[model samples]
Target: MIISCYNEEHTILQVIDEVSAVLPQAHIAVFDNNSTDSSKSLVLGRIQMLANSANIDGGGGTYQSFIESSAPESKNKVPKTQDFAAKINVESKRAESKRLDSASLDSPANDTTLFNATSITPTSINPASIIPTSINSVSTIMPNGGRLSLFSTTTQGKGAVIADAFALLDADIYVMIDGDTQYDTAFLPQALAHFCQNQLDMLNIARATINDSVHRKGHSFGNKLLSTAAAIFFGKNFGDMLSGYRIFSRAFVKSFPAQSKGFEIETELSVFALQQNLRVDEIEAPYKSRPEGSFSKLHTFRDGFRILFMIFQLLFTERPLLVFGFLSVLSFAVSLIIGVDIFMEFLETSRVARFPTLFVCVGLGVIGVVLGVAGMLAHLVVKGSKEARRMAYLNHKKIL
Candidate 1:
């Protein structure tokens, strides 16, 4: 499923077509997150065309099976009529059946056949009553033998869109990519192979090589810094923590608590997997900039801060001891600095003159000890919660 937002009107169709060509067996979904441009219309048109083609192909099989199965019963004919008049009536019936068969071929009856059905009564096929004249009626559309859905939404946020997708879609492997043509569909086979062959829960496609000059330097630098921070806290080596191209097993997608509402979705996903101790792997894939006139929606500094904040948030929530322990160490160090100055003053002079410094030292030391103890207690709570979460994840059936 590809979650698209504003202003990808130029490359949206290309992305859809290319992904379909590469993964012919894959069902493609396009979620239009309320684009102001003609993106929704363009995608809806192309997807409908794809659906029609699939329907024609699948409906042909269905129609053929109907003919073959019914042919067997019609082959041994025992005419009930005993006169020439009845013979003429039989001939008329044949003509009517032939006319109906021809009409079925031209009618949108095949449009309702959702798959290449091996068993279907010829009598039940009905032509589509109303041809879709606009996108408003597209909600009733269903492609034959293949699944393709186009949805329109008014909300923003990439993570929110993806969470909705995970809830709505039931697939063995759920894949997500940026709607813009940054990631190539050519590497999909290799990316999927890792999950199939190994014990992998999530596969993140890293943009190892930046092929286009459109990628800003700040974006690259921020990614490296954030990746480093994530590694330090989460203990997982991620090449591109910000990469939008990712694949998740059905279990992971179903159990993941996606709380992020914005671009920090990628970070949240990675952290969730790590927190659960799920097997995660990464593939270094090439990144291409969008086609001419297409632009990125990311605010580097703004999103970077959000990503950083999430890293710390997860660090505290998932590994409270480490974060709070570090705070405790810092506080103790400050207290020691003040205490040492007080000690030096007493050593140089006959009496200690700084009463405020003494109080400040005592206060910081007490805070440090209190935080350290709180961290220890919180770690136990976090441990029990993690155990429960792991059990819940394990109880869910594995998607094969």
Candidate 2:
């Protein structure tokens, strides 16, 4: 599993814990996209804590439950929404807490119980509850499934982070989830089950229910609008175009050409699958609100327009004949309208009075023909590229 995160210190650990719980056998890697807060430290500490437990237990199966049980109460609580002032106050507290001496943090690594003297909880650590029920209970974690690695980059885009992660890890299957906990991890097993059983190339987790305020509602509507447009253009209806939860097979991942550097990556992913004619499917998952103090990185209007622009771009690139042919037809119709008026005026007056209008009509007609011819040429180029991609994909080994 690959997690892409920003300044999500408030909710990152809980999200990882949940992923670890639901998919015990899955290897998890987190890509921290230049976070300034305690996000990196908290994630690293939790990972260290888990690693310590696994080493002591000899196997991960028995150690995971202990980590879950000992998690702080704040990790489970749904905090009340706070205003900017309250958010700033909370951040200040977080900064102060993160300033703890690194010497002390590393000191517990040698001890049996890492959290015994430290406040490692995300929101507010309760020092009293850190006592060991045995040395085994308070052990630190590093992550023990396949291998755990936390990669940090100074980059600022989700697509770049994911691209880097893909290049770094070699796996049969890849699952991506937003660092902020929005979709429940409990549904992950079912999502993966389909891909494995059906030999599918891509599986997108569609949000069956979005539980948030007006902004979320608007986002849902925008997603539907974009999905509808995509369905029309691509001939495949992706249930949700903006959902961050997705699973991809090795072929799909390796063959994919990722270009978007922002939220539009989701749209690009779906379009790439459609263009490649890959086996793709979707599973319904419940969407929950972001944890309090954790916010979204997407600019709705900006990203929404970007998504729409991507769709149009794919349309022209994939089906240039259809898109530009329509534009050409529309231009031709406008020129015909202007030409008819000019003809009537000249017939009545027995002279050509509107020379500029005649020139404008002629220009429109020429542009219409030029666009139509260009679209045809582009269509041929796109077809050739599609054939090349399809042949390459066929030569690649299938994950299933």
Candidate 3:
């Protein structure tokens, strides 16, 4: 099962086509958010919420066997520099060999690949790349702004909506891709097989390749900066923090707590796995710029700031001591910078020249120091509680 949120026409069409070709048995779904373009025609229809009906309820959610579950929802990329081309070539070989068609495809040295799939095309091929197979979460939106219900997707964001869609369909394996078509569809089989073989909870296709362009300065720079910050803040080794290509198993989707409303949905999903130490996997894949008609929706300063703030928000919420302690360091840096300025002033004029600067610096420094110490104590308490919970979880799982 595959779920997608599409805001553009050309990209959405290409994305639908590509996945259908690679994973023929996989279910495809899309949630359109009142797009102004012909993006509707490109997609078969819109996805909606499950209705309280006799057939839908009695048939036991026909999708339930394939997807994760029904849900009350809210809402919820690419590639490397050119020099990484050689690495892609190498990975391509490994991937072909690493293709897992069933319950096998372990780590390395043992995987399966059928020769007939050799004609699989990359997303950059053209608009006519792949074709649509089957549709599950179907919807229809009249141009006048009201949704004329054809089928219920019952989704808000891309991730949450699709998660529910897959659950409704009862799909064992679920895939996610950007509506923009930047994430290569050729890797679908590889990711799918990887999930099946390892029985992994999730597999994300990190944008590991791209043909760089300077058309969208704000989005490009924001993405790069965020990627760098995420590496440091979350200790993730991913090159692209916002890569859209991902795959997951029934277990992960069933238990997935998808609570994000926008692009941040990806961050929420990735971090949840990393933070919880779940069975998550990463694969490098080709990336590309969207077609000309589609507009880039990234805001470097605004969105980047929002994402950065979200990281801190999650960090502080999850690890308060770390957040407070880090703030204390900044507070100390301010004091030191001000202290140096004061000394320099004294050296030049042989007297204290900046009483305001000294006062402000010293005040902040003392407050920061106080908060830092308090945060340390708080962290110890939090840590102990977390340890207890972890032990309980482990014991319950019979792992302890």
Q: All candidates' lDDT scores?
A: 0.65, 0.68, 0.51
Candidate 1 local Cα displacement, residue 350, angstroms:
9.5
Candidate 1 has its poorest 10 consecutive residues by lDDT at: 98-107
Index of the highest-lDDT prediction: 2
Clashes (backbone N, CA, C under 3 Å), per candidate, total 0, 11, 29
lDDT of 3 by residue, 279-313 (tens): 77787877776678776665567666767776766
10 residues in a row with least lDDT, candidate 3: 113-122
Candidate 2 regions off by >4 Å? 49-144, 210-215, 343-351
For every model shown, what is its TM-score relative to the native structure? 0.75, 0.74, 0.57
TM-score of candidate 2 to 2 decimals = 0.74
**Candidate 1 deviant stretches above 4 angstroms:** 47-144, 210-214, 341-352, 397-399
lDDT of 1 by residue, 5-78 (tens): 56789888788767766664344667787788998888666654544443454433221111111111222232
TM-score of 3: 0.57
Candidate 1 global CA lDDT score: 0.65
lDDT of 1 at 78: 22
lDDT of 2 at 172: 68
Using TM-score, give the best candidate's number. Answer: 1
Cα distance off (Å), candidate 3, residue 345:
20
